[model samples]
Target: MRSLLLLILVAAIIGGIFFAIPYFRAHPLGQSTNPGATPTINTTATALPATGIGTIKAPDGESIGISDGTVAFATGGPGGSAKMQAADKLKAGDTVSAQSLWHSALTSDSGDAESLIYLEDQHVLNAHVTSNTPYVTIVVATMMTGDNASVGNDNLQGAYVAQKEFNNSSQLAGGTLVRLLVANSGNDKLYADTVAQQIVLLAKADPTFVGVMGWPFSSRAEVAINTLAKAHIPMVSQTASDDALTGASPYFFRVAPANKRQAVLGAKYAEQSLHAKTAVAFVDPSDPYSQSLERYFAQQFTADGNKILATEQYTVGQKGHAALPQLLQNAESKKPDIIYFSGYAADIGVLLSNLPTSGQFATLPILGGDALYELNYPSSARAGFKHLHFTAFAYPDEWDVQNLQSQKPKF
Candidate 1:
């Protein structure tokens, strides 16, 4: 009887070991069984390069890399993939299909501001291309990601509206059609010069390619402008406002007021409207736009008998972010009457969001140049600063009114 019981126990133990081995193999340790759970990835492994993954053949039989095309430097996420797909469709002469893919990509990326206008322009332009109709291409190059994305979107929309009207007008008299090509210059316009080189290639390959427009950021615009100017391409800036860009190139022209004027206006507003006597200015040293605004603002403020307490410097990336607390602490220590940030909206948004509600900084009015006009902080974040003000290129309603009037020209 003892031997029988021992045999049964041994058999049961062996069976349990077999069952557990298969279970462990199927569901390894430290792995989640939940379907929605994300699997752990080895981030330290050799990762793929963000740009320059694939190549597309241009009209001139030249292979264009991913870094210098429709979605320049935006070659990582779903938006980038979709844009690449659209490029493939465009190359196949299927602009109608490409338009759909572009729309999808834009929607997925929450980039819907220029959607309708972009689609309309693409349809019209692609029709001309497919029919072998004579058309002139104007490339709109700007920062299409990060804080400047809104500005870039506005630029694209404005260009499309102009293109549509020009193409439909009797003034053209059935002349060469105008097509706008969007070239994204990365998050902070880091790839603007590379994109400019690509535009030069396009101009060389296609005789119909005429000009370039929309360099909204100064630092990047300076480099890009030099490249395009050397290539003898006529270029126009929609909203770049740095004084240094005044004679950046013979080919470059801008309709917007320079930073000197904008800073003077900003200084006057701070003194007269905000009742600020002394100020501290925050600037991004790497960005010429920020530097220009800071220099001009300081000069104007001091000229108006107001003192500048200090000027704080910060760049854009990880180092800047890591030092933000210390920078804010230093700025707070200055105890100035007003705080002026002459940086782009992204950094300012971070500064504003992190600013403490109850402190020496509390109830202090913050002023900035037009670069902060696109500050898109959430309502909760915005509520923290009741006196936040920035100079704008123009009022929002005026843009709508002008657009309407342009569409319905009298006489």
Candidate 2:
């Protein structure tokens, strides 16, 4: 009887301990000891893939499609897709519809720079391509999106005007029509080499492709020029002015003066015109054009018995922007008489826009290279600087008949 009672007591104690374990776990040492409250356990076991997210598609779900005499690679947003549609329409010989789409695309929220190719130019190219009349093609390779799009549009306008004039006149033997093919190289011409390769393929397949024009940036222009030169194609750039591009290729030619000449001209203007003795040079070292201009300008300025108080280098994107405040402080500490910016308008515009109007930089003259010609600063931002000057390859008012006659002999 005693042994059985002891066993029964042990079994009861074990059961009581088991019951108390769950109660302690649920209530812990806190005051909340509700009988119905039980601890909840989440059993979800879904795991994220090791490869992470897949490739992101464009917002508008459009892909770049290249065709003979038509190239559509502008893929940013709605504006890009709309322009692609416009290209399709133009290829189908629907000028009216294509022009309408193109106009709408320019005004869309995608911030596409206005294109200069008009209905007449599109019709001319289309007509020449389909008709049997002998025609020579000139591909205009340029960045049709991002900050440099305006310059690209200007290049297209110039090429179109030339094509129109040539096709209208009896210049070509046997009445050969002039056809223009536009090749968009994307923002800052990041895809310039790839587009150049496509242009080479086009030239190989079609003998009518005679030349190319408008390589706006020197950073990627060297590679593109070399590729085209290897294929025996001639290229002419209206804006690329890096000194390194002087002998990049035998087929490469430029309408703009090299960086060395432009830098010397800028330095002379600063010393003679502005009477500046000390300057602060702000350059984007990542860009070949900016670096070349900065190097040459510094050399010429020092050679002319002037001093560069500080040479601050900054890139062109977010990292560069983040460093601007520090760069400005450093430049201010140097007590420069003038500021020389050897960067594109995208960066210089931001720098000037945010510059305080009452500081030492207010009245300090800011002289920049030809890249500053594209500056589109707001009126409020323009008020921040008293004197802002930039060099230009040409001035419209100076290109009169007399000026042309005087300059013709030199050319």
- Weakest lDDT window of 10 consecutive positions for candidate 2: 48-57
- The stretch of ten residues in a row with the least summed lDDT in candidate 1 is 1-10
**Per-residue C-alpha lDDT of model 2 across residues 77-152, encoded as one tens digit per residue:** 5676766677778668776777887777767732343233444456565666687577665666776555566555
User: Which pairs clash in the backbone of model 2?
Assistant: none
Q: What C-alpha RMSD separates each model from the true structure?
A: 22.7, 27.7
Residue 281, model 2: lDDT of 97
All models: lDDT?
0.62, 0.62
Model 2 lDDT vs. the true structure? 0.62
Provide the TM-score for each candidate, comma-separated. Answer: 0.72, 0.73
**Candidate 1 lDDT tens digits, 1-411:** 111222222222222322233333343322223434422212212222233233333333332222222333343455767767776776676767778887787778753423444465575656676876565555666655554565666565555545555566622334555555667665535356556656655655555555666576777788777666656666666567889888767667766789999899999999999989998888887778888899999999999999998888888644476776678778888888888988866667667767778866778788987676663555545764575788876553443576765643221
